[model samples]
Target chain A: MSESTAQNAGKLSDDTVPSALMDGEFLQQLRQQMYRFSLLQLDDPQLAEDAVQEALLGALRNARTFGGRAALKTWVFAILKNKIADTLRQRHRFVDADQLLRSDAEEDIVDTLFKESGHWHRQERPAHWENPESAIRDKHFWRIFEACLEHLPARQAKVFMMREFIELESHEICAAAEISVTNLNVILHRARLRLRECLENNWFIREG
Target chain B: MKKCRDITRLLSEAQERELTPSERISVKLHTLICSGCRNFGSQVDILRRISRAYVRGAADEPQREEDSGD
Candidate 1:
């Protein structure tokens, strides 16, 4: 090597070593965040615990190659997210969306709506809209809300939890969910709209 | 400044604290002018708060698994 290039290479090893990349505190925070995140996704405490264990070990084993582009949490979560996605993908055994939607052509969503809750706009506007103290006092309101959230489609539910509950960035969510930014936005939008409609019809309107 | 529809669109972004300064200003201006949009924004904020609360509650609940016919 040239003398100057050789000198710079020697300084690189002195200045920074890749072996010193791992930060124990950073990894612990990553583990906690991933645990909370996985809990929201799986809705099962046992599954979340198992997932966090796997993610922590994965991060530990791969720490040497970590490039440190994003925040440590983001990097670890990116790995953990892939693990969660793979688990979900294995569990998913359903017909394609288009085929399911097409074959259920006779299943009128309007009829389903009518049976579930009538004339959504015709119902009285909720007073709880102004004061959530009443909503907090009413356990039944939350019970229905939880049911609606649980009934949401899997991908929509995942995106909603990642963004709304975990407060993860949209880019991170898009990366974790293996979806395009546009699709992630669409999923979140639909999830919120459905949640709003469901809550309005079931708790807000019915209570009124 | 954002219009009412734009303000509503930003509601989710705002809840996640993802809105840029300019976007926040746009939504702020729209909400200031439109009562309907303000009410809509309030409801969205409430929804976000409740979501977080519910998640916390779920995390704290005793671990129990029932085969609810999944």
Candidate 2:
């Protein structure tokens, strides 16, 4: 707390970032960021591990070549992004529409949460989560959040991650997933609903 | 005012695209009195931000390797 500049150290705009990249400490930070980012994209644990390893090596060995034009993350993520794309191309992933579409069973889950008049049932209303940002700061919380995501249907999770994790534009996501703009919207909607419900019930409420 | 179900959907939709002016007003009014919807909206909003941060990988201690998302 005594050193004022220390707190601002994480900002990307700070020139110290590029210098930090060469230090062993920052390399470790870069690796964890890459691993988590890769997991969301590659989806396979082993493949994501490989991608992260390759990306880290690339960044470390070529540290001198990195231009300071982007944040350290933006640079590392670009390297890892190419790695994941290569992995996806090698494996030829599938995006199944039949599976991606909302099912009656899933709708039934949502239906039970709301009444015929579209009001929330007493049991399913959202409880206040003070300091919601802290949810990401806690590792156990992230594990619970990931478990909630794991509970979703595969295609639904895929669509959700495509938007949430990769930050793809809607039209690009729809095109990549081979679903209509409307269907993509519906899938993302349901994914958020379930995750919100799960986190509210299982994490935030318990914490509060 | 929109129903809870409708408002919930709107909060979620707001994540995907811009809300219409009417839709925006309806949500503001509904969430103002509705604690449930208000909390729901905030959580959904946080979910978007934190989920991105999670991928961006917040600084934290290492945990056991667990496979999540596909």
Candidate 3:
């Protein structure tokens, strides 16, 4: 795990936004980044676009009050996160993590992975994945990863993004998403499991 | 003896929860001999690393024009 540490993957590289807020080029660039992040987190291009616009507008409206404590990129991202949360709330897309634990259907997927004798089903056996570290450097791989993430059920994807994307600690996710610790772990475990299955099916084997 | 399925469960659980000492020993034993389980562990590790990078790299936002600024 140490050779492959990506958690807290480092802060936004450029903290400086133009002192001139609303510089067409800068906002334009920032808008695109915001939109991409929102889309990945929300998986709805239209809604993601809306969230970026709202976030930018809100940031500009309150631009004067910007105490320089946080990097501009961090500040903007903070606003965008709130916009995304609000959008998810309005859409009723937020999942109660505890509910995920009760969904017996998930157990069916896990069950199918093994035979009655508890051996790997041929299809479920882990195969040689081309070095994933190399794949991470390729821009196209991120798109494939995003596509795999989008394949997750709405609630599962949301929770997964919160813990993994936002990099919130498990306890924080439980508080914010109103899920119990057990439920949070269960959801996370499933997300990781399903994501591995998805990438294996969609990316790894396909390339092989 | 832990089955491959059992070892796989522990591998995923290790990502989110602490494994009991017995569970750790079982996984250590299984993965030591099992190439598939080791691949499984590294695959999950890969997934975790890439996901974090993908998220944080959004701050950099490569200069590609895909949206209409709508």
What is the C-alpha local distance difference test score of each model?
0.57, 0.71, 0.69
Task: Specify the CAPRI tier of model 2.
Answer: acceptable
In angstroms, give how far residue A204 of model 1 lies from its true place. Answer: 3.2
Q: Write the per-residue lDDT of candidate 2 for residues A140-203, one digit (tens) a residue.
A: 8877887898898777787787777667678767666566887777777778888888887788
lDDT of 3: 0.69
The numbered model that scores best in TM-score is: 2
Best by DockQ: 3
Fnat: each model in turn = 0.11, 0.53, 0.40
Against the true structure, candidate 2 reaches a TM-score of 0.70
Give lDDT tens digits, candidate 3, residues B1-70: 9898778767876877689999999999888988778888887778778776665554233332232142
lDDT ranking from best candidate downward? 2, 3, 1
Worst 10 residues of 3 chain B by lDDT: B59-68
What residue runs in model 1 are displaced by over 4 Å at the alpha carbon? A1-49, A52-128, A205-208, B1-4, B17-22, B58-70
True contacts kept of 3: 0.40
Question: Model 1, range B5-57, lDDT digits (tens) per residue?
Answer: 45555775565557888887887886676665566667777778787555444
TM-score of each: 0.51, 0.70, 0.66
DockQ for each model? 0.09, 0.30, 0.34
